[model samples]
Target: MTTLRIGIIGVGGIAQTRHIPAFLELRDQCTIMALSDVNIERARETAEKYRIPHVFENYHDLFSKVDAVCICTPNKFHAEISIAALEAGVHVLCEKPMALNVAEGEAMLSASIKADKVLAIGYHYRFMKEAQAAKKAMQDIGTPLVTRVQALRRRKVPGWGVFTNKDLQGGGSLIDYGCHLLDLALWLTGNQKPISITGSTYNRLSKTPNQINIWGEYDHDTFDVDDHVTAYIKFENGASMLFETSWAANIKDDQEHVSISGTNGGLSVFPFELYTAKNGMLLNSEAAWLPGNEDFGLSQAQNFVDACLGNAELIVQPHEALQVSQIIEAIYENDKS
Candidate 1:
C-alpha cells in the first residue's frame, strides 16, 4: 500500500480537533507532512505540536509538498484554495458549504474536472452510523414524497471564530451547522433536483442587546448574518422539502431531525427510526446500535485518503456539493425577493 502525504491549510480549531487527528489515526496509510496558516506563528505552533515536517505561511507554498490537501479555511476562501490546490495536482478535501455561492462552487467543480483530481466536500454527517442505516432504510421506503428537516439550537450561537461575520462565513446556522443535516437529507433522497425555492432569514436574535449565548458572546452590533432561516423547496420529481434551521430559538431544547415520507414508508434520522404499515398495522423500528461520533470523522478521512490513492471512489462528489450550494444560494436570493 502506498502511503499518501497530506498537507493541512488553515490550522484552526477544526483542523486541530477533527481533521488532523483523523489523518493521524490513519498514520499507517497516510502522514501529515505540512501545515499552513495565514498566521505564521499559529502554523508553526501547530506544526511543532503535531510534529509536522513543513510549515508555510502561504498554502500555495505547502501544496507541492503533499499529495493531498485539507482546506479548512473560512467559507470565502474555500473555492479559491480548492481550485489552486487542484490545479497544483493535489487532491482536495474541502470543508463544507463548498463555497459562498453556486457560481464559486461551479468554478471549483470545473477546476477539479479540469485537473482530474479528487474533490470531496466535508459533509461528514453522511458517515454517521445512524445516517448510514437511515440511507439503507431509505431504499426500503420507495420514492420520497416529502422531506422535513429541522436543525435547531437554543441560544447557542458560536462566540468563537468568524461564524458571525457574513463576509467571512457566508451564513450562520444554515450554512455552518444546519448544512450537515440538509446535505444528509438531500443525499439520502438521492440528490433530487430542486425546481424552485422560497425562503426567509432572520438575524434578530443575534443583533439584540443583552442576549444570552451559550457558546460565548459576540459583538451584537457587528452580527450581520442570519441566526435563523426557513425555506420550502420543490423538487422536479414532485417531491418537496420543508426546512427550518436556527442558532437561537425559544424552543425547549435543541433538535436535529430529518424525516422523509416516501411512497411506501417513512424514516427519521435523529432517533434512527423507521415507520411503515405491515398487515394493516402501524410499525416502527429503531436502530439498536450506531457507529460512534469519532468513527464518522475517521470514516470520512479514510474515504478521502482512499479516493486520493485511487483505491476507492469519492462519496461526496463536487457536483453533488455544488447542488447544495445552489439550493443555499436560492434560499438567500429568495429572501431578497
Candidate 2:
C-alpha cells in the first residue's frame, strides 16, 4: 500500500479525540503529515501530541502537503474547506451535516465530482455492528413498516463551544444530534428517496440564557439554539421515520435507539435485539456487541485511505450526503413554516 499522507483541519476536540487516533491506527497505509486550526497554539499542541510532522496556522497551508483531509470544523466552514481541498486535488472525509444547507452541499458535491476526488461524510453509525445487525434482520420484513429512532441526552447541552451559537453551527439538537439517527434510518432503508419532512424545535430548557448547564455554563441570554427537536419524515418507498432528539429533555432514556418493524421480523438496536416468528413460534435474539464500531473516525480514515488506493469504495458518497443535507434543510424549513 502506498503511504497516503494525510492532514487534519480544525484540530478541535473531535480531531484530537477521533481523527488523529484513527489515522494513527492505519499507520501502514497513511501518515498524519500536517495539522491546522485558526488557534495556532492548539494546532501546534495537537501536532506535537499526535506526532504529526507539520502544523499549519491556516487550513490552506495544510492542503498543499497532504493527500486528504478530515474536516472537523463547525458546520459553516464545512463547504468552504471541502471545496477548497477538493479543488486542490485532496480528498475529504468531512463531518456530518455535510454543509449548512442544500445549496452549499451541492457545491461541495460539484467540487468533488469536478475534481474527480473522493468525498465522504462522517456518518460513522452506518458501520456500527448493531446497525449492521439491524440492516441484516430487515431481509424478512420485505418492506419496512416503520422506523422509530431516539437520540436523546438528558440536560447535557454542550454549552462550552460554538455548538450553542446558531450562526456557526447552523441549528441545534435536530441538526446536531437528530441528524445521526436520521442518516442511519435512511441508510438502513437503502437511502430510498424522501418525499417530504415535518419537524419542530423547542428552546424550552436553556432559553433563560443564564441557566446552569450539565456540560458547561454559558450565557443563557445568548443561548440562541434549540435544545430539543422532533422530525417526521415520509420516504418514497413508503417507509416512515419518527425521530426525536435533545441535548436537554424531560425524558428517562438518555441513550440512543433505532427500533424497526418489518413484515417477517422486527429489530431493536443499541441493545442489539432481533425478533421474528419461526416454526409457528416467536423467536427473540440479541447479538453480543462490542465497542469495535466505536472507532468510526478510524474506520472512516481507513476508508478514505483505501479509496485513494482504489482498494475500496467510499461508504458515504458526496451525492448521498448532499441528499442528507437536503432533507435536513427541509426539516428545518418545516419546523419554521
Candidate 3:
C-alpha cells in the first residue's frame, strides 16, 4: 500500500468542497502533501484547516514536493499548470472543461504522453450510479439515433468566485454547469465523433438587475458571459443531439436531464427510466434501486490514484475529455459566426 503524495493547486470552492474532501477520503492510498493558490492567505488557511503539510503561492514549487497534483484553478490556467506538472513527472487530475479550448487540451495530452504519466479530467458525473446504470442499459438500446440533454437552473447563478468572469472562467453556464452533462452524454454515447455543431448563447438574464440569484449577487455591469446556451450537434455516425443549458430561466425549478433514443429503447438519466414497446403496448420502467448515496468525488479520486499507481486504467482519458472541449469550442465559434 504505497501512499501517493498529492498536491492541490487553486484552493477555491471546488478544491475546498470536492477535491480536498475526496482526496482526504482516500487517505490510505494518497496524502495531501501540499497546496498552492494565488491567494497565499487562502492557501495557508486551507492547509491549516485540512492539516496539509506544505503551502506555496506558486504551483510550480508545490509540484516538486508531490507525486501528483489536482488542479482546481480557473479554466485559463488549467493548461499551463497541467502541462508543467505532467512534464515534471507528476500525474494530474484537472477539474472539468479540461481547458478553455481544444488546443490547450491537446498540449496537456501531449505532455502526459511525453511524461508517461496519467492525466485524468474531473468529469465526476460519469461516476454517478444512475449514469453508470444508464451506460449499462444502453446495451439494450441498440444504435442510438438521438440524444437530448438539458441542465437548467432557475435563478441560481453562482454569485461567488470567478464564475462570472469570462477571463478567468472562460464562459458562464454552458462551460460551468453544462459541461458536466455534455461530457456525461458523450461518454454514455461512447464518445461519438461530432461532425458539426450550431449554437447560440445569451447573457440577458445576467445583465438584468434585481434578478433573484440563489447563489448570491454578482456585478451586472461586468457580467459578460453567457447565462444560457442552446446547440444542435451532428455526429459522424449520423446520430444527432439537441442541448439546452442555463444558469437562470423562467422555470419553476432546476432540471437536469439526459435521454437517448435508440433502435430498441430509450432511456433518461435523472429519474433513471427506460422506455420501450413490448409486444403491442408502450412500457416505461424505472430502476427499482440504483445506488445513489455513494460519494462520486471520492470514487473519482480513487480512480486517479489507482491509475497513477498502474493498478487501473483511467476512466476519463484526456483525449476523450478533449472531444468535449472541442465541441464546446465549436459551439462558441459557431455562435460568433
Candidate 4:
C-alpha cells in the first residue's frame, strides 16, 4: 500500500475526538506528518499526544509537507482552509456542515475542480453500513413521495464551548446536530432538486438567565442562536420532506431517524426497520438486518486518499454536498421570516 502523508488543522474538540484517532487507525496506509492549530500550545499538545513529527501554528505552513489535510475547524473556516489546501495542490477532507453558506461551498468546489485534486466533505455517516443498506432498501419503497428527519434531543442542549454562540457556529443544533440527518436524507434521496423551503426557529428555553444544560452550565441569557428548528421542503421531483431538529426540544425520546415513504412501502432508519404495504396483512413486517458500525471517519479519510491516488471513486462529490449546503441555507433564510 502506498503511504499518503496526512496533516490535521484545528486541534479542537472534533480534531481530538474524531480526526486524530481516525487517522491513527490508518497507520499502515498513511503517514501522520503535521498538526496545526491557531493555539500553538494546543497544536503542540495534540502533536505530542498523537506522536506526529511536524507541528505548525499556521495551516498555510504545513501545505508543502503533506499529501492531504483534514480541516476540522468551525463552520466559517471550512471553505477558507479547503480552498487554501486545494490551491496549494493538496487534497482536503473537510468536516461538516461544509460551509456557512452556499457561495462558500461553491468557491471550495471550484478550487477543487480547478486544482484537479480530491475534495470530500465529512458526511461520514453515509459510509455506515446501515445507511448504505437503507439506500439499497430505498428501491423497495419505489420512488419516495415523502421523507422525514428528526434529530431532536429533549432538553440536552450542548451548553459548552461555542455551542451557544451563533457567531462562531453559524446556527445551533439544526446546523450542528441535525446536519448529519439532513445529509443522510439527501444522499438517500439521490440528491433531488429542492424547489422551496418553509422553516421556523425558536429559543424559548435559552432566553432564561439560568437553565439546565447537559454539556455544562452556561449563561442561557446570552444564547443568541435557535435551539429549535422545523422545516418543510418541496422537491422539483414532486417529493416532500419534513425536517425537525433541536437541542432542547420538548419531545419524548431523543429521536434520530430518517424515514422514506412510497406507494409500495416505507423505511425507517435508526431502528433500521422497513414496512411494506403488502402480503394480505395490514401490518408491515420488520427488516431483518444488523446495524452498521463502520468507522465512518476512517472510511472517509481512506476514500479521500484513494481518490487522490486514482484507485477509487469519490464517495461524496463536491456538487452533491453543495446541494446539501443549498438546502441548509434555504432553510435558514426562510426561517428568518
lDDT of 1: 0.92
Q: After superposition, how far is residue 164 of candidate 1 from its true place, in Å?
A: 0.7
Candidate 3 has a TM-score of 0.97
- Please state the error at residue 193 of candidate 4 in Å: 0.5
Residue-level lDDT tens digits of model 1 in 92-204: 99999899999899999999999999999999999988888898898889999999999999999999999999999999988998888889999999998999899999999
Top model by TM-score, which number?
1
State which candidate, 2 or 3, has the greater TM-score. Answer: 3
Clash counts for the predictions, in order: 0, 4, 0, 0
By summed lDDT, the worst window of 10 consecutive residues in model 3 runs over 287-296
Candidate 3, residues 1-337: lDDT per residue as tens digits? 3889999999989899999999898888999999999999999999999999899998889978999999999899999999999999999999998999889999999999999999999999999888988999999888999999999998888988889999988899999999999999999899999888999999998798888899998999899898999999999999999999999888888999999999999999997899998899999999888545678888899899999888999989899999999999999989999
Any runs in candidate 4 off by more than 4 Å, and if so which?
282-293
lDDT (10s digit) by residue, model 2, range 109-163: 9998999998989888877777777778778656787989899988888956699
Clashing pairs in 1: none
The lDDT of each candidate is 0.92, 0.84, 0.92, 0.85
Each candidate: RMSD to true structure? 1.2, 1.7, 1.3, 1.8
Model 4, C-alpha of 301: deviation from truth (Å): 2.4
Residue-level lDDT for 243 in candidate 4: 94
